[model samples]
Target: MAASALISPAIHAVRSASAIVCKEVIDSHVLRIDGYSRLKHMMHGKYIRSGDFHAGGHAWRLLYYPNGSQLQFQDHIAVYLQLASRDPNDEQVLARPRFSLLDQLGNPALPHDCGMHRFSY
Candidate 1:
């Protein structure tokens, strides 16, 4: 799993023209399961979550569902990205997340990509 964000300054109307600079921060975390077959035998809708990790100054985690998150998709697997940080001001965080299932040789077994997402309380 990989997460990235562009932390840009808030734009404002100025009487004088000026140049604004912005930077991007990228971070990633990988969760490897040694006994995936055993996990798949667990009850449906059950999930295992990764530990909290930081990306772009925010805490995040990943949820892995071996037997799928719901009964309708029990034959498949599911993964979700969750925001683990709470803001006192209830602000929203923007991030782009990408998930992939890697094979034993460290290659992508499936393609899972997502667009920009807004995360809040």
Candidate 2:
């Protein structure tokens, strides 16, 4: 029969709804990497990170290891895409990522498209 006890239950009764949406590209940005071997991206310190880029109102990065991710395949290259940050209120984000490796004259030697994937923080 106390005022403080009555308020405690109501404070915990909060809910939120989740929904999905899509965005279209009105324009595009092409980042040309010539002499890619000479480009060195290094994290300055333990807390520092490299290769930060922006796309679709979000921060993203591409990590590349020329010597492969593991010891087994040192001859090959390892690449990955990482989402740097996300809004807490947002539960899911739809993404369609495309990647290409070009030759010296800017022709696509290898192209990859990881069609429509869901990303959540």
Candidate 3:
């Protein structure tokens, strides 16, 4: 939902007769909009990409998933925040913080919220 919140306007959620169809159109667009050309203009060196990890994170970029995608997204979003936090940038542009498997443990994982700390299970 956090990721969708950021992508909604830029990419409308298309609905179709079949879930497969909707996923085809909507999901592909997510990947395309995130392609190199778009990334060059939109993301630059900033943008952190974390997702619902209450169960250790799922690689659900709408529909696409790959190895380490979860961690990759986290690192990406963090980079953006790190840069924007120090410079004049739009904080609202942030990817609303969401839960991750990283935090679905004994204690809450406030990595960024608390200097992005790490803990062992």
> Which whole-number lDDT from 0 to 100 does residue 23 have in model 2?
52
On residues 18-85, what C-alpha lDDT tens digit does candidate 2 reach at each position? 98986585322345544444432331111222466777877677666655566686555555566777
Cα error, residue 82 of model 3, in Å, equals: 13
Every model's TM-score:
0.75, 0.56, 0.18
Q: Please provide, for model 1 over 12-92, each residue's C-alpha lDDT reduced to its tens digit, 9 standing for 90 to 100.
A: 977877788867677777888778888898646789998998888888988889988888988998888999989786689
Worst 10 residues of 3 by lDDT: 22-31
Model 2 residue 104 lDDT? 77
What TM-score, to 2 decimals, does candidate 1 have?
0.75
Sort by TM-score, best first: what order? 1, 2, 3
> Which candidate do you rate higher for TM-score, 1 or 2?
1
Cα lDDT, model 1, residue 74: 88
The residue-by-residue lDDT of candidate 3 on 12-121, one tens digit each, is: 79877845442211111111223634444454444435332221121222222222135555333222211112223332222333332243344534433323322211
Give model 3 RMSD, 1 decimal.
Answer: 25.0
lDDT of each: 0.84, 0.61, 0.31
Winning candidate number (TM-score): 1
Q: What does candidate 2 score in Cα RMSD to the true structure?
A: 12.5
